[model samples]
Target: MASIDLYQIPVKEVHGVKGKKPEELLTLGIASVGDLLDYYPFRYEDYTLRDLTEAKDGDKITVQATVVGVPLVQMYGRVKSRLTCKMMADPLFITAVWFNRHFLKDQLKAGTDIVLTGKWDQKRLHLTVSESEFPGKGTSQIGTLQPVYSVTGALTQKWMRQTLKQALTQYGGLIPEVLPQELLAKYDLMPRKQAVALLHMPGSMEEGQRARKRMVFEELFLFQLKMQAYRALNHDRADGVAHPLDMPLVRAFVRALPFTLTESQKNVLAEILHDLQQPFSMNRLLQGDVGAGKTVVAASALYAVVKAGYQGALMVPTEILAEQHKRSLERLFESYGIQVALLTGSLTDRQRRDVLGALQMGMIDVVVGTHALIQEDVFFRKLGLVVTDEQHRFGVNQRSVLRRKGLNPDVLTMTATPIPRTLAITAFGDMDVSTLNELPKGRKPIKTYAVTHDMLDRVLGFIRREVAEGRQAYVICPLIEESEKLDVQNAIDVHAQMQFAFPDYKVGLLHGRMTPAEKDEVMREFSANRVQVLVSTTVIEVGVDVPNATLMIIYDAHRFGLSQLHQLRGRVGRGEHQSYCVLIADPKNEVGKQRMKAMTDTNDGFEIARRDLELRGPGDFFGTKQSGLPDFRIADMVTDFEVMERARDDAAELVRRPDFWTAAGYTLLREFLQREHITDSELLD
Candidate 1:
């Protein structure tokens, strides 16, 4: 490769000019041609112009003709400035215009040969300039392919254009190729530097797309390697929780239940049993849709631990959940004389010490709590089974550390979010997964219906009917207050109106702003049937399973994720009685109406999650943040499920190669190591 003149560098290099010093370019970290190539165009700088007669509305292009007349300033309204210039371009006359760019006031002067690139606002027959620069010559022979660089605060387009122009100064020479030889040939991938350069300054759209394909492949490859390493290091022998799957305790606990287990529950529980029998540690995810009877399945595992003479540790996200779980288990254990203790940060020092002492003494058969269960002072004498409620709510490391307290405790993680099957495989490759897809037997399916705010009166009438029938209700509002800053609904106003509407009955309010004690009191009131109506936020989603609460009315239901709405609906229907879920939505917004309709259509969480993913598109399903899952910027777990499956298989096979960690994958390793900000990497380090 030989160097060439800086002036002839591609348009992108000039479009990517950085800061004042060349050293400042060092921090921008243009370490590899791949790095530079991966940066995408913010928007198109389409200089694709049309002839005067062919120019349509909003056409961005450039034309060079002698400015036959002076540029005139035309201002309209309180804020409108337009620079229009009439020029002769042969048989047709062209009018070039610039908007609001007052600097162009002098630049588009009379008799100046100005080449303007702008959109043709056709209604006014004006070529409105988005940007303008002299092509250094009359547009008589202008270059057709122009580069548009993504601009940043420290770097102006002109500066970037200049700097990138400087880097590509040696236009005739190619940069060093970094991909391994065999892969380069096998995949038919272009030389690394050439691919990067092409992406930044492609001759055509097809070439740019091809470049994108290669870069996306590389990113996913590195991510695959990282996931592979994580699985290997975490799942190897001397690696798993050796479970004493004591069937006697499990059978006794199951037989004691008043209700029959749903086949789905039995099957998932059996899967957990099988995993316990394996030599490898039982790192399993129990994905149950909202109201899928996850608690009962967990109780079976806890019983097994106790019968096996080992302790079980169940951790929850909130103190209320911890206490609720403890109360449920305590009731279950009381039948068999088994012991369960609850611990939380709110516990008095003496009470905590007593719980900790009992735990270390092996006196506590099973322990349930918030983070207090994982404290250094809280040690289990022979802890073996660990269950995390709402696993997604806990950080990966936090979950791992809690598990670490025991002797390779078999970990049972449960989530209300029913992930699609494909994502479950890739994101949870190291963990065995069991899904409880059915509600426990005798549990009535909640009849769901969608209603607009206009139908609120009828919905309220139905609620009144339920109340008259001696049933309780939950009126869920999306927000806590009418934030002057946001347009969200607040629970305060809703509770006030319901209080007025249901003057014959008691109404209670609960929100995040309320203290734990306050929320607990409200839930208790509703649970005991003291409050006929509880108007609250999502706080009610995880409230105790009240058998008599038959109505769940959600306002602005579209504001919630489908999974969440399902959880809210699950709050009711725990009883033998038929339940109703009323979704109050805006009828005008067809999209919102459709989303609410879909929720009313099915109670299956997996189906809802799939539909929600489809409705929200994969790229934005997680709401624009890199999720807590694997680092796949290019391969979205939600969108690129097919690609992820292929990549996962390919990666697994790649690891089988004797020389996988050899020089062949050095660049891939370096790429994985670049993500150093990771906090919880025990799973996919």
Candidate 2:
């Protein structure tokens, strides 16, 4: 047989994949032979032979036995039946029962030798057969490890296994090796062909683990290589603007601030200043807790850019956040003779045109807006700096488009949601990272507690007392309106309840369904203490600051992730007065309970983020689909963290070589990257 390109051959062309099987494979995302080969099993079933006498109750084991008597088939309902047979081992007799498998009666006869795999019930000396194989049958999977795949659309495990086996046997050798020989030898990695085969048909669990390690390393290595390549290209570009560091101006601006800068914030600002002075454009991510004072560091950077005779742009996710930042920045830089303007969709046509004209003509030193900053008509005279707040909220292309407004502008991305170190390196590998873990001085830790529905009255009383003391409070719900499928409190119902409970105080409602203007009005009232209790959904999860709000009561807290719960908790602790967070939930599962416990245990956002990653996995940690996190076929961000670090280091070293693309050992890697269209443009996007 002629060797074929696995990427070109369709699943239908593979042997034994006939009829609807081709369509079934398509539904599983197996378009070509290559995708089929990459569709690895999620788990494996160990069917190694075990002694029947030594098997304990509830232990899944495989045992060889002989049928001692005729099998009896008992019919129950229309489609339900039971097949029972007695099997005798060397010195033990066990009864095997197969529910809904009545056809097996024809296969089991007196004195027939069979191998059965299932849980052992020692009390009754019985085995519930999950799989059975006859010794002399046409094809037996008795004493071997079996691969269990995730199948759908009328696909069975047996059919999937058979088709994969045939495909591997035919095209396994033709699968090209993308990694260099030196790496393979240095890491002691299994060959590509051998690893692929072993993943599907490993001799033992150890072999399976080894195969998984090789694939994990490959996936992470390639991903990091692309990241390093982007970094290299950015550093080597000649269009990068080397912004002059005006230390005197920066010091004067810092001194004008009302509060002293924390040591952690100072160190992070130093790092950003250093990056700005370099010839290369600064592509950095600044991550901190909700009240960690990241805004000060960003303000300093923007001040440096404006003093250097260039413009800066600050982009945020929501209009409310944009308005807040603009007010804050205006207050910070007004003394330095720098002008800041706001641009958003809410602006009238005349207002938008005036701001655009001012930006294009070098009148405005800094512009703050939402997605409006990326509009085609929005141009900067010399866009020296681009700062995006809540970086995960914006898509990759959205940020990239804003960056393109300037000629290799120094970009600074900010996020209050602390990311795990492992995720930071993998997701933002192309950018330098600076973390601020310490909160500012005079900031007290928020007291947290978890309660059930029975404590609702006490919680409301606590909030009422706090509001009576001239402090504001927040009441959060999981849903904006009542959900038929989910049994959780909604914002509207809670708002009405709170109003009735505290008739003397004002209660406001907020959710995502409200217009931007309505939300702004509610938040404005809450910030001014007019609305003492604000009943809201998770829309208040990010960048809503009201230092007077000292109490937060979250309903159905189990529905929120740990990180999200942490963010909501941060809304209160901003004031000097002691703050509190009350989580009202009755979790039914261990994970939900753990999430609630993690929130009440500590106020550290990084620790909460780490726990959330472990509990929810990477995909749901922060919505990886929209966060620019790569999808790996086998690599897990939590379990394979060490392997990811190794891959990152290796890729960094490889990309630093001067002749990386032209080297002899890198030919295959280069070709692979080209074949997959992993170029600078695509990687950046």
Candidate 3:
């Protein structure tokens, strides 16, 4: 028989597998042998040999013991079962229990030899285990490190292990090495096949670590190559506008500002200006904390583009934000003879037609809108620059559609979410990034407080006082409705409580479930001082800028990520009034306490983002898909920063080689990138 290629074979085709179906395995993302092989373990268990008598509570151990009695199975909850039994090794007696695993009754018979691996709870006098099976025939392999995979649906860990073992045994010879031998030697890495095998069944923890390191490098290397390829494609042509630097209109707009720009703003403005003058399109990312005056820097660049006799479009994620930007830009550009128009979904058909006609006639110098700008009928007379606020909310395809409006328009994307420096390079390697690190003069920092449930009444009283002083406040809840599983506060319940507590003041409710028109109306009411208090979720975390909203109270704040909490706190402290952010929660653990402390310690978004990455790795930072990053199985952007950097450098060098197109592993790397949709450009656009 011809040797089977694991990548080309479906997993269900293997013999002796009867119960598992294609759809069941697909739930765990294992459709083929390749998917199964790439399905790395989320964690490893040290099943190494250890004395059962010497084990402490919560210590994982593997002990060889013979069953001493028949197992007794008992029903617990509606969907739970417990099986208990006694196992012995001479003087050592272990009471082991398995939950919801009724199949063990047949395999675990009296006088049967077995190796059990699980944690021991001495107080309960039971060994809480998930795995128990007949001892395999191998002295050295009796207790070795093992892989614990995350299986779903009808697929159990045993099924995954058995399937993978069969594939490795039957088709291990066909596992090709994608990494070059010289690169492997330089990194002191093992062969690809050996690494995959050792990762599944390692003799020691050291061997597992080595195998994991090689896999991490492979993931990072592939990602770096894709990013470099995208960058080269974006900058390869000089088909974009080179807006002139010296313009009277831009100088006038800057001079007309009420306050002087900060040094950081000036430096970033210079950087953007340089990119605007490049022959190729400008793909730059402007990052800063809340209230860091990134808007002004973007406005400066847009002003320059308009002065160069080209139209510009600023796309915000929300209609209210688009309207706000329109107002701000109008005030700044009115005296400079620039016409700014707002185009949002909320606009009437006639209104949209008027703006679209004006844009086609070159009457509108700048257009600000939400996703409505990317509509088919919307066209720019000469779109030289494209600015997007909160870039994460917009995908690469949406940005590309807008970019196609002009002949390779220079793109400037802005975000208030301050990503860590290392991750920024990884997530946005194709774009030149400039950060505004300082707040403009006269902007006051928000005072943050971490409070427990005991202080809730006091915090409510303070918010009442702030409202009485002619200021508005925001009350944030994590959930829209009460969840059976989560103990967090809901917006509806909190909104009712606020209304009942303060019957004299008008309280408004706003959440993600509300329509855009409804959200816009509520925000307008709050901004116009009609609503004394706004009860909402994190929907207001992004672009609602109310100068009078000086007080913020977040219930069950520990449920939010540190960076998101920072953004929530930023909704306030926008005006001359001294603002306060009260975070109410009794943290359940040290990580929660640390997140609360970080919020209270500093108002810096970047610092909070870094700490968030440390606490919850890169996966939860912005979610793997939304961040346009590969869902790395083992590589942590925090702990593996050095490894990622090395891989990135090597990938860059390899891509620049003269023979890169025909190099070894080039096809495999390209195919992997294509499979992942990394080169689609929709992610980076």
lDDT of 2 by residue, 277-356 (tens): 88877889999998999988999999988998999999998998898999999988877789999999999899999999
- Residue 683 of candidate 3: its Cα lDDT? 47
Model 1, 161: alpha-carbon shift in Å? 4.9
Model 3 TM-score relative to the real fold: 0.84
Q: Quick one: ranking by TM-score, best first?
A: 2, 3, 1
lDDT of 3 by residue, 397-437 (tens): 89889999999999999999998666777776688788888
Candidate 3, which segments miss by more than 4 Å at Cα? 1-36, 52-56, 65-93, 98-114, 129-141, 150-176, 180-182, 247-256, 467-470, 479-525, 528-532, 587-594, 614-620, 623-626, 633-639, 657-685
TM match of model 2 to true structure: 0.91
Off by over 4 Å in 2: 1-36, 50-79, 84-95, 106-113, 118-128, 150-156, 174-177, 180-182, 659-663, 676-683
Best by TM-score: 2
TM-score of each model, in listed order: 0.81, 0.91, 0.84
lDDT of 2: 0.88
Per-residue lDDT of 294-389 in model 1, one digit per residue for the tens? 988898888876877888889988877887899899887787777899889887899988999999999999999888777777789998889998
The regions of model 1 sitting more than 4 angstroms off are: 1-46, 49-71, 74-81, 85-97, 102-128, 132-151, 161-194, 248-256, 422-430, 440-445, 587-594, 610-627, 630-637, 657-685
